[model samples]
Target: MDLPSDTPAASRTPRPARVAVVTGSDSGIGRATAVRLASQGMDIGITWHTDEEGAHRTAEEVRAHGRRAALARTDLSRLPDAAGVVEDLARELGRIDVLVNNAGTGTATPFVDMEYETVREVIDVDLIGPFLCGQVAARRMIRQGDGGCIVNVTSVHEHQPRVGAAPYCAAKGGLGLLTQVMALELAEHGIRVNAVAPGEIATPMTGQEDEDVRRTSRPGVPLGRPGDAREVAAVIAFLASEESSYVTGASWAVDGGMLRMGPQAGSHLESDAWRRP
Candidate 1:
């Protein structure tokens, strides 16, 4: 593949913002997605909560692709910042054509032991943040009187329950419904809403080494490997493009095959021998 710095520029007409806004884009799937979009000739509005350096690196990659990249320092845990964040990007970029709600957080904890603060933060970031951004983007698109696309990055847990991830699951589940609602509400205005539910991607959020995350994590996947950031990004790009004019309110899972098994442990049971009558 062409590294951002090595990418050849393709010419295109200038559109407002001419860009895509990717939250949590300083690293991981967000970073990869931002760079991939830039390579396709879109400018980028990148958001980061903590990784300024990583954000700059992504901006550099965007520049390497001969596209503009603007970085914003944002913490989605604060509910009030969501709309403001979208507004700020709009002001800086001139327009918001594509909005990718990729910023989120989760923890591995039992629901009973979960603290309210953690629950609040996770919900605010994973669900409310996207809601706010989507609301703002929809209004803007309506005002512009042109169609736009919204892609929310969710997870497999949005469909299936997971152990030790109550708030995360709740937030993503809420987001899943929100995507549908937005699609319905915005469809008449020429806006499309969709989501990408990534299974296991080797990113910083997973807190696993890239190589190890790719290896050990894939045994359950029919494809036999963890998803790369680029794989998920491709889905987002397609949703953002005119190519997906008929697609909306759909969550595309990027996880290998982890969700296909109802109970991972049960897959090992193999019956009969343990049931002594």
Candidate 2:
């Protein structure tokens, strides 16, 4: 029996792709994660809900790091939108070696006055969206017979409740537990699941520079400053790398000491230099 003289050498197996799909990657933490992963040698797949220009900027940075960047528009509140994102990423970049469920929604409204729709939407985006993407990514990774990592971009709200973010708190809390549950279930298959809970990081979503959110936010953090997106991305990069191979089912906080900051932070740090005049 003879075969064709040449069949493109079986497509070269695509260099054994290592790619990450980071949701809400157009700005802030998501964008930072995409860039970091690229720097660390993983092709990046980014999704943006509203920040198309920012997403493109991130893609350019990811590309600059010498890795393929697949960018898309995603609205996690829509179930179909959430589920399809991972599939699209895998199709575009060969295979998904890492999945970062980073997109989310938050509101500063009191729980009692909150409409049911508001809470539902947050839960859908922050919690359900991650679950769907994880399920899809795990299936693909398993079929490829190569284990991978799934990092959920949760919030400090997962462990410490915020005053007015009822829905955000609820969704992140669920994500915390869900991360552990998936870790337990997927360990047998060699897949790892973990979470990154960030505190008051400066991001487009928070619009912390918008004067209002900024003034009200300073008093809440012990570091006396909001975190930068790059710091959070560094942690995510560690979680996705082979260096952290022994780590899984863990929730790491990148929140400039915010979660541990108690109500007494005001007593420790004095602002006698400037008054709210």
Candidate 3:
């Protein structure tokens, strides 16, 4: 982490307005995170794989907050140059201070029935993509000689598995460990890394597309409903902010207590008359 000779002392000051690159920010949790980081006064770099229009909409929200916004198209699964978008955004925004690796895809096919290509695709998107993006961001941060942050948007599956989502579960679990390793390596350079694992968020990914979480109901979730994308974004924003300066290599759960229901669920069942094996 060598500083340039001309770097100003003030540039090293705490809490300076910074820049962030958020991948797959066209909609859902990515969109909410871009907007929330904007509201916090950071210029944003937005990317999309398929939703160009939604990316523009997210940029509009960022500009509405009076911060600069840059947009690009990134397919993390195909990394011709994993850092290309980060370089472009850094050139446009002048520096990269935060990187949120939020772009990912999943499949619900059972492990036995899953196609090899589908499993590869999920791993490429969920694990490999973030790994490359984080590496690029870290290199940039090290070159800039200033601390930075990286937040990987994992899922409850990072800690627990689902019935038919073997690839998704494996990739997320891999990413959770990757986050810790990145944190360990980058801490010496003042770079922080962490993860946010959300459960049943009301987003397009969960088939809730734009639905309000407050209006939704879920009996299985201890909190009584799915979470909002914004709710998850709030935790991400914290991890990206100076407020979490001391936090690194940690995975914060924003799952509305859904992760706690597994054991309690069986115990709470009313038809438990037989203990015979």
**TM-score top scorer:** 3
* lDDT of candidate 2 over 128-184, digit per residue (tens): 999999999999989978689999989988997777788899999999999999999
The parts of candidate 3 lying over 4 Å away from their true place are 1-16, 80-83, 266-277
- lDDT per residue for candidate 1 within 147-187, as digits (tens), equals 78899999998998777788899999999999999999999
Q: Candidate 1 vs candidate 3: which has greater TM-score?
A: 3
What ranking of all candidate models by TM-score puts the best one first?
Answer: 3, 1, 2
Model 3 reaches what TM-score against the true structure?
0.90
TM-score of 2: 0.86
Cα distance off (Å), candidate 2, residue 183:
0.6
Candidate 3: pairs in clash: none
Q: How many backbone clashes does candidate 1 have?
A: 1
| Worst ten in a row by lDDT for model 2 | 208-217
lDDT of 3 by residue, 190-218 (tens): 99999999999888887997887878888
TM-score of each: 0.88, 0.86, 0.90
Per-model clash counts, in order, read 1, 0, 0
Q: Report the C-alpha displacement of residue 195, candidate 1, in angstroms.
A: 0.8
User: Which residue runs does candidate 1 get wrong by more than 4 Å?
Assistant: 1-17, 209-217, 263-265, 269-277
